[model samples]
Target: MTGIKSIILAGGSGTRLWPLSREMYPKQFLKFGNTSLFQETVLRCLEVSDISEIFVVTNEVQKFFVIGQIKEMGHSIPPENVLIEPEGKNTLPAIFFGMTEIEKKFGNSVVGIFSSDHVLDLTAMETISAAESLASDFLVTFGIVPVFPHTGYGYIKTSEACGPGYRVSEFREKPDFETAEKYIKEGCLWNSGMFLFETGLFFEEVQKYAPSIFTSFENGGDINEIYANVEKVSIDYGIMEKSDRVAVVILEQKWSDLGNFAAIYDEFEKDSVGNVVYECDPLLLNSDGNLVYSKCGKIVSLIDVKDMVIVDTSDALLICPKSSSQKVKEIVTELKDRGDERAYMGQTVYRPWGSYTLLEVSPEHKIKNITVLPDHKLSLQLHYHRSEHWVIVKGMACVEVNGQQFFLRPGESTFIRAGERHRLSNPGKVPLEIIEVQLGELVDEADIVRFDDVYGRN
Candidate 1:
């Protein structure tokens, strides 16, 4: 474990768990109790590697979530350790980027590749550490011992024993229910998407098997250019399935990818009627085997529902049979096809400074309840088409209109006309809350033009 480093892949959109998870706020950042899945992954990785040796690969949009979550955990990773991909090209490129960075910094070390959205028990770290011994000769992948016939996970077939693990005979895609049962009978392991790789051997395999991906990064001019030219492929397709040196280490740990609502149902505690409820109290008359998640804190009554998934948010609600929960991605696709804003954007949007909740919106005006974190400030910008009226609701606000700066306490108000450069800052220890009303013909986010930004927005 001393020579090992970790790279967390956290760029997934998580459309499978929509209505609760969105493009702007993915499942990795969603909290169940206190810690998020991303935070849980970070904590798991810390068991095997130092904080400095752990690297995270995320896209631009979710980078701040990675940083803010780590900061909240009372630890700080080096700024350079947080690698931002210009765009997502799937797991192969993201892992390659992390491996490339580790090679530059540490040089041919053993690196553990992990998914940011997985739920794994800490006991699995021992198996992962044991795989390090086999990393020099084989591309060691951790495969979970199958507990049931699960159609949601891919399968890895094992050949013979090799150095605390087995040689991977073949990799199989997610199959039908019958095929899944057959796979379990054949003693297949669920592909866990976790790996321990020796950088030298990893590079060699990449160069030999995925030459195009190899050459694109090797001849890199710019990060954006490299990403643009790289193929969008998963590591399993691009490297693992084709590599003969692949080894499988059996991980007998409590694990779940939580890919869909049904998977989420498996993670939580169930009631007397076999129902799982989160964040809301639901009246169940004859409901059984149902998952009801409501963020709006509304009273939901189920009379005779059974094996159903009911997820309610501020802007959208999803009601589906538990057996068809895997088809949630199709709903997201249809919403995108219909050009619905709820497909990507949630009611509450998080930013580096803080977050804003859309309270009301019409054709003529938009209302938002904004909260600025302590010592954080918004960008100095102006909206060409919208005029904003801000009323301080909590804490203290330092408002800047044009070049003039003034302080406003709770219940104080200010107005910024269209095309006026303004900024809002929280100068107090507590969070600054305000009611912002925007009036204009077009009051969308794209109307903003920033003159200055601390978080590097253009």
Candidate 2:
């Protein structure tokens, strides 16, 4: 795998798994057993290639998350290898950006593109390797054999059998139930969106067909300007469907996109009564065919409930039947229209140093429980319309207010008035916990004016 590099696309909002997955923290970061879906993709890629040869393409906001999760998995990736797109221009531009980087380093080599949130069998690496071998002539894509009629996925119809793969006859969009069943009957496979491409050849096709995208990256202009000028489209519509040398390799194992709750329920472990329960225990009298998750540690008791998906977070709860789980994104759309904070953030917010949870919030006052990792510190900043009082509840904290430094222990406290520069530092071996009470007219994150920050935020 010397000339091969793995490109993981991880810039999806994943609104279908709402309440647990928000715009900032999506489903890829949510834990299942002991590992998350994104972490699982990294581990799987490491099995086939070296860590130094792997690349991740995410947005500006998700760059910190990618770094934190990779470090938490005990792997260190080069900062240059973690490419951050200015804004998401869909898969075509994202893949084009990553492919351009790979071309600079490895020349005309093989690259495997994968989605970070998909579930794949551990044995699928052999199929991936087989696809990589065919990358020199054809743009290779993996197709999963359909066990049933799945209308959520697009179909890849095979025209003729090639060596270890098949020549793609057509790329079909998501079909209705009748059309999906017809595709299944005709031996079509679900398009996995995973690809193996020879870097130079792929770019050559892009230049031939989608010349604007190719020229934008090739001209060495500003990325943000290039993205704004490029078209918002998927690779399937822009390249794969139009290319003559497209190939498909069949994956003979279990796989799922996990796009909605019904797909999750199908892949998740169920009880004898066909129920998927997570975290909190559920007492059910006659519940069957239900997927229940309670993240707040609250016991959920149900009587005679069946075929329902119940998800309870700190701020929101969703209950819908399994058949209607695909419509969950509509709820997210409604939230965005209504200007709800739950549309973008969860109860606990993560940062590069540590995390903070909203304890209470009101128009005039807001309270938060902040945790700082060992040897971590906050930015040197000041607020425009808010003052903050910090009470150290655990560990030691080094405080700096208006350029004056002082140390505080457990049960100690400090205050900084509005327009005064302040910073918080954890100087102890253990994690530092503080209770922060903010007061003023505007008490929000947008009020901060950062002078210096280690995490490089503006």
Candidate 3:
């Protein structure tokens, strides 16, 4: 058997799952349990493959989220293997980059490309092994048996069963409920986005069918050049739908691409009224089949509201019917049009070293409750337009302002003038909590000039 390499694609803005899953930090990083979807996805391959064989491809902004998640799980891959794309350009280019990298490092191995945001059954090792063994010239993807007539997922029609898979006859787009029921009756499977293929064979298909893809990548330049020019097409559109030698492995197991909150509600254990509520201290009267998540810790009781979604974060609230989940993207679109920051950034913002939850913000100033991880440090940088005041509220801090280095304890503070180099870090056993107040000409996030960074920002 060829040594397996897993390419985990952890890119994409899950705007459909807004209020919780923002543009900067999407659904992949959202936690269902102790582990995130991405972390669970990373750990999924380790059952049949080695830890060193796993390779994650994420953007520069969310790469640290990946690292932090893995660290929390205590299952670490080499940092070199965690390839960061300069920007996201859909799945094909990301997979191609990982395929090329796997070939360079491990030599034409079978690479399993899995999306980070999905939840799949892990007990089907036999099906996966069979697909891996049979992946000679075809890209083998797991097609799930449809439980309900869902229009969100694509369909795959197959011919005779071969080993654990069937030769794919055709790929169909998402259909209406009637068509979907017809598909289930016609022995069609839900196109589960998981794919297994040989790296060399995949490259051959790409070179043959997607020559423009190869040309856009230009014989694999740097990651920036690749992401900058690669056509924004998914694996289904770019390769799987167009490929002649695609195979579909029938996975008779529960699978979910939790693309939005509706799918999330389906996976959850519902209450007596068939409601899936998280974070909202619920006292329900007549709410049934609804998914409501609240970050504000308020009582959410309603009357006669059935099959709806109510997501209330600290800064925003989204309420829509279950049928209108697909239209949530339009809300995000309008927010962007109106320069609404809530669409992209949530109340909480992520950094390479740590994360800051926005308590408040205004024109001349912004207030944040910052949490820095132990042994983690932010970029040694200075703001061009803003100066910052840091007050240590919880743990000890290692502060550097201008040319001075000092230690700040609880209730102690420090300030950095505009254009003066400064860095805040936690060099303690506990998490450092600081109340940061930024006063500036303009407190925009883009006013930073990094001199040194621990997470390869240079």
Candidate 4:
């Protein structure tokens, strides 16, 4: 594992788990307990690689989540290792970007590409480490031994035995129930979407199979320009399915992608009545085989409900049968077609500085409970159409209005007229809390005009 590095893909919108997962805040950032799926993936990567050796590929919106969550774990990755894509061009480009970056600094090493949102037992890392020897010549993928006929995942058919794995004979798409059963009977393994690639061999395959994508990255232009030109394709479609040097390492450890609510229900611990309850204690009279998740911590009661998926967030509630959970992405599409912001964001949005919770909103006025982390500051910005009044509820605040700086204690207040540049900072050791009320004809996030930002926003 000396020359090995890890690449974590963290840019998926995760629409299937929506109402809990949003475009800006996806399932990888959601906490299952104290740790999120993204953090769990990072910890798993740490078993074989050091923090500095782990590279995370994410987009602009999720860059902070990647940095913030790593900080929460009492560790930090190299700032450059957190590669931010100008725009997502799917897994092929993302993985290529990570491989290119690793080659630049560390030079043609063995890289493990992993998904940010997956559940896996730690024993899987040992198998991953053992696959490095085969990775030198083959594009190695971990194939989970199918426990049942799972139609949700693609199947990998192995032809013959190779070094610590088998030669990949065929890659099957996600099949129908009957086809999935047939494949399982024929000893096909689930395609795990995780790969161990030697940089030299991976680049060679990419150059041969996906020459357009290879040329775009090989030209060495700006990342934004490169992403703009490259086609949107997955690694499976671009390279793995076309390459002849593919190998499948059978992973015997427990694994789940948790692609939908049904998959989540399968992973969670169920009650005696086969009900999975999260975040709140629920009263159920005759609820069997139901997954109830309430982030609002409200009392939920279900009577005679069976095999239902109930997700209650601060902004939306989703109720669908467990069998129909795969259709949740259709609901997200409808919301997007209707131009609903709820499809992209939740009531509570995370920022680089901290987080803000939307308390109330209307045509003329909007209110938010804003929390700034200790020693953090908001950008020096102004609103052309909105006037804001901020009242500090906790900690110390350093307020700057049009370059005149002043300090405000708890219970103190300040006002900024429309078009006046202002900024807020938390100078105390504790988090600064404030209630911000905006008055304007246009009360939206698009109204802000940032003059200077430390986090590099335009």
The TM-score leader among the candidates is: 1
lDDT to native, each model: 0.94, 0.90, 0.85, 0.94
Model 1 agreement with the true structure over 1-458: per-residue lDDT tens digits: 46789999999999999988999999999999899999999998998999999999998889899999999999999998999999989999999999999999998899999999999998888789878899999999999888889999999999999999999999999999999999999999999999999999999999999999999999978889999899888999999999999999999889999999999999999999899999997899988999999979789899989999999999998999999999999999999999998878899999999999999999889999999999999999999899999999999999999899999999999999998999999989999999999999899999999989988888
Per-residue lDDT tens digits for candidate 2, residues 119-235, read 998779877886766899899999999988888899999988888899999999999999999999999999999999889889988988888888888777777878878878799
Considering lDDT, where higher is better, how would the candidates rank from best to worst? 4, 1, 2, 3
**Candidate 1: which stretches are off by over 4 Å?**
none
How high is the lDDT of residue 60 in model 2?
A: 81
Candidate 2 residue runs with Cα over 4 Å from true position:
none
Poorest lDDT segment (10 consecutive residues) of candidate 2: 125-134
Q: How accurate is candidate 1 locally (lDDT)?
A: 0.94
TM-score of 4: 0.98
Least accurate 10 contiguous residues by lDDT in model 1 = 122-131
Q: TM-scores of all models?
A: 0.99, 0.97, 0.95, 0.98
Off by over 4 Å in 4: none
Residue pair clashes in candidate 3 = none
Locate the minimum summed-lDDT window of 10 residues in model 3: 121-130
lDDT of 4: 0.94
lDDT of model 2, residue 2? 41
lDDT of 3: 0.85
Error of 4 at 122 (Å): 1.4
